[model samples]
Target: DTAVSQTPKYLVTQMGNDKSIKCEQNLGHDTMYWYKQDSKKFLKIMFSYNNKELIINETVPNRFSPKSPDKAHLNLHINSLELGDSAVYFCASSLVRGGNNEQFFGPGTRLTVL
Candidate 1:
C-alpha cells in the first residue's frame, strides 16, 4: 500500500561491483521517474518513463539503466559501480500532465561504493 517504495535503503560496496535498486508505486500514476541526489542535495533527473516507454533520458553514465515493468514501477540497475556513483537514488511518480502535478518520492536507496 505504499505510494512509492525502494529497497536496500543503505547499500555499501566496493568499486567495480554491480547492484540494483527496486522501486514501485501504487498511486495509479501514468508517469514515473528516477532521480539522483548527490551530497550537495542537487536533484537531477536520470530517467522518466510513461507506460514503459522512455520519455526522458538525461545525460547519465551508461553504467546506469532504468527499467519499467509497468506504469507503477521503475527500477534502477547499475553496473561497474564506482565511488562517484555513490548517491541517494530516489524513485518518483506523477501524473502525465498538469501544472499542479508534483512527483512523489520514495524514502531513497543510498548506494555507497568504496
Candidate 2:
C-alpha cells in the first residue's frame, strides 16, 4: 500500500526530447506538488495543485508543466529537456488541515539528459 508513487524511477533521454512523468497519491489529499532537486540537494517547488487549481512558482521555466486530472493524481511534463534539467523530480501530497500540513513524498524520478 504505497501512499504515493511515481512511474519510471529512472529516465535517460536526449537533451532535446520531451518526457512526462506520472504520479498518483492514495492519501486522499487535496493538495499535491511537484518538486525538483538539483545535484546540490536543494529542493525547489515548481508547481502545486490544490483541488485542481494550479499555483506555479515564478522562477520555474515555462518548459515545465504540471497537470492534475483529479485530487489523487498529478502529472508532470517537461518540454525541450536540457542538461540542467537532469535532476530528481519528486511528487508530494499533504492534507491541508487548517495549517497542520505534513507532506508525504513519492519515490523520486531521476531524469538524466545525455
Candidate 3:
C-alpha cells in the first residue's frame, strides 16, 4: 500500500473553475504538507499541517486553502482558479515538523487550467 496517496492524479479545467484535491498518508506522521511544482520544476511548500494545525507559507495565495480533517489527511481547496495556479501539487508527510526527517511524497496531482 502507498504510504501517501492523492486523488484525481490528472485534472484539466477552465481558468475560473474551482477545484479540490484530497491527500492522505498512511505513515502515521505527525506533520503533512502540500507543495506546488511549477512548469520550471521549482517546488515550493504551499501549506502544512502539524497534528491537524495549519502552518502556511506566506507566499501562497489566499485562494488556495488547506484543510486537515485529521493528522492523516490534508485536502486543498482552490477558489477562482487562475492560469498561474496550474501546477503539480504534492502531498507529503514527516515524522516531525522540521529538520532531518525524511518526508514521504505522494505521486502528485497535476492541475491544468485551460
Candidate 4:
C-alpha cells in the first residue's frame, strides 16, 4: 500500500485546458499539502489543508485550486492551464504540528503543456 499516491503520473496537454490531479494518503495524517517543482528544481509550497481547512496558500495563480474532501485526500485542479504551469506537482502529508514533522511525498504528477 502506498503512503501517498497520485494518478496520471504524466500529463501532456494544450495551452488552455482544464485538468485535475488526484491525491490520496493512507498514513492517517491530519495535514496534507501540495507543492510545485519547476524545471529548475525549485520547490514551492502551493497549498496546505489541515483537517479540511486551508492553512496555507502561497502566491499561486488563481487558476490553481486545491480541494480536500477529507483528511486523507487532497486534489489539485487547474483551469486554463498554461505552458508556464507545466511542472511536477507533488502531494505530501504530515502529522500536523511541531517543527520536526516530516512530509511524505507522492510519486508526483508531471504536467506538460504543448
Name the regions of candidate 2 deviating beyond 4 angstroms.
none
- Identify the superior model by lDDT, candidate 2 or candidate 3: 2
* Model 2 / residue 92 / CA error / Å: 0.2
Q: Which candidate's lDDT is highest?
A: 2
**Model 1 accuracy (lDDT, Cα):** 0.87
The TM-scores, one per candidate, come to: 0.92, 0.96, 0.94, 0.94
Pairs that clash in candidate 2: none
Residue 89 of model 2 has an lDDT of: 97
Candidate 4 per-residue C-alpha lDDT over 56-76 given as tens digits, one digit per residue, 9 for 90 to 100: 665898998899888889999
- Over 44-89, each residue of candidate 1 has an lDDT whose tens digit, in order, gives 9999888657855557988888888777788899999988998999
The whole-model lDDT of each prediction reads: 0.87, 0.94, 0.92, 0.92
lDDT of 3 by residue, 1-114 (tens): 999999989999998898999999998889999999999999999987887578889999899999888888999999999999989999999987455678999999999999
Best by TM-score: 2
Summarize candidate 2's per-residue lDDT along 82-104 as a digit string, tens digits: 99999999999999956468999
Clashes of 3: 0
Q: Of 1 and 4, which scores higher on TM-score?
A: 4
- lDDT score for residue 68 of model 2: 88
